[model samples]
Each structure stands twice: as C-alpha cells, then as structure tokens.
Target: MSRTPPGTRADYAAFTPITTRWADNDAYGHINNVQYYSFFDTAVNAWLVRQGLLDITASAEIGLVVETGCRYHRPIAYPDPIEVGMRLASLGNSSIRYELAVFAPGNDTAAAEGHFVHVYVDRATGRPSRLPDALRAAAESLRAPGSGSA
Candidate 1:
C-alpha cells in the first residue's frame, strides 16, 4: 500500500496545542496509537466550542464521527508539547471531513497525520440533518484552498 505524505504547518488553517499526559503513554513507552485520535477529536471539537458552533449539553444537532484513519511518522511521548493542525478537507450538507496533523514542538512537518469524518445528526432524532448556517460558516473558514465540497 502507498503512504500519504505528512503535511507541513503551512497546509493547515488552524492549530490547537495539546499537552501529552503521562497516562497517554503505552507499555511501548510512547503515546499510544489510539491517543492520537483523541487529539484529533479534541482539536476539532475545541475549535467548534470556541466558535460557539457547539454547546455539548444542549445543541439541537451534534456531529457523530463516522470514519477515522491515521498514519504515524514518528513516536511522541509524555511531556512533549505538541500541536494539532487542522483543515477542512471536504464539506457536505450533513457531513464534514477534517484533516489533522500532530506536530512536535518546533517541527514544521507532522509527526502524525490523519482524517475523520463527522456526520451531523439531530440530537433528538438521530437522523442526518443539514448543517446550520453558523456551523457551516465556521467550517468553511477552516477550508484550505482547493479543498473539497459536496
């Protein structure tokens, strides 16, 4: 299988800083592979919260992660300050694809990179719903040039 190249800081539209917790490390002595996904989730949702696009307790709509994948280029461990870079890869009526990269302090290239797709659904009905205008606008602001849409 072919591997996707790691992205540079310039490729992302937004960034979130992450602190590596000691418990995030695995028996192998580096952050567990699964923890990378948590970083991705935190980065996206935090951005949404900051934009007032999400109110986790009472929002009428919520984004449910539908798909996720990651590629690791290097190991990062506890105490290493990292940053997660984010960009919108695609936007759809009911879903969005977020591409994210993890950068070690001072590095321009990613130590890990991946994507996750979130399908927006009505919180009470659990059915797909069109994205709210504010939410859509917030997402659009994160789109890098030449990104996708549907």
Candidate 2:
C-alpha cells in the first residue's frame, strides 16, 4: 500500500547478486510480476544455504513459506545485473520473516520489495517446531542492528 518501497538498505544486512535471464521477461516486455517472487525466494534460500542454516534435502527441521507479498516500483528486464538485499525481521518460536529488496544495477532504490515468512516444521510430522539455535543465530546475523521492523 506504500508508494515507497518497503525494504531498503537499512533493512538488509547482507546481499546476493542476481542476473536476470532472457526468459524472465514476459509479454509485457518487463520482468513478470511473478518472477519477482521467484527471485525473492531464490535469494533468501540461497542465503540460508550459504549460511548452512537450511537443509533442503535432509534436515528434520525444514522451513515452508507460509506467506509472501511484493510491491513493484519499476520494471527489471534481462541483461542487467541485480542485487537482492536481505535481512531477518524476527525469529519466532517456529517461524522467521525475511525482508527482501531487488535492486537493478547501480540503483540505490529498489525495483521490487517483499517479505516471506517461513515456518519451521518437522519433516515427518509436519508440525511446527522451535527454530534451531544454529538457524536462529544465522538469521540474527543478517538482521541490521536495532532495525528489526514489521
């Protein structure tokens, strides 16, 4: 509902570079709205993997995205390099909310911004579980000091 982008540099403590693909553009001649979500997902999970917090294949505790929303301010097309800025808003007993911003090359403002809530669950039971200490620690490191927000 905000004209201004939601996630910004102050909100993200880490960054991941992304390259737009030729196929990512839609008939509208810009990156499709849905593709932004994919980029959002990829950036967050890639961070989790890089930090050794998420085990996509074998961990008993796995995160399932329960909610996501995005706001697009401008179009991002192929052939341009981008950076996805990311941070952890909070770590609940069983869930974590990640703030994300997609920035085009050389742009200080974001093209799209979003947040995703991932609920950790037991793989076999599909029941919510307390976030692992390691996972929580990893997520906390990505949060900007004194900047956790809703």
Give one digit per residue, the lDDT tens place, for model 2 in 39-122. Answer: 889998899889887778888899999999988888989888889998787778999999889988877887888889999999
Task: Tell me which residue pairs clash in candidate 1.
Answer: none
Give the residue spans of candidate 1 off by over 4 A: 145-150
Judged by lDDT against the true structure, how good is candidate 2?
Answer: 0.85
RMSD of 1: 1.6
Tell me the tens digit of each residue's lDDT in model 1 across 38-150: 99999999999999989999999999999999999999899898999999888888998999999999899999999989999999999999988898888877876565552
Worst lDDT 10-window in candidate 2: 2-11
* Model 2 ranges off by over 4 Å: 5-7, 145-150
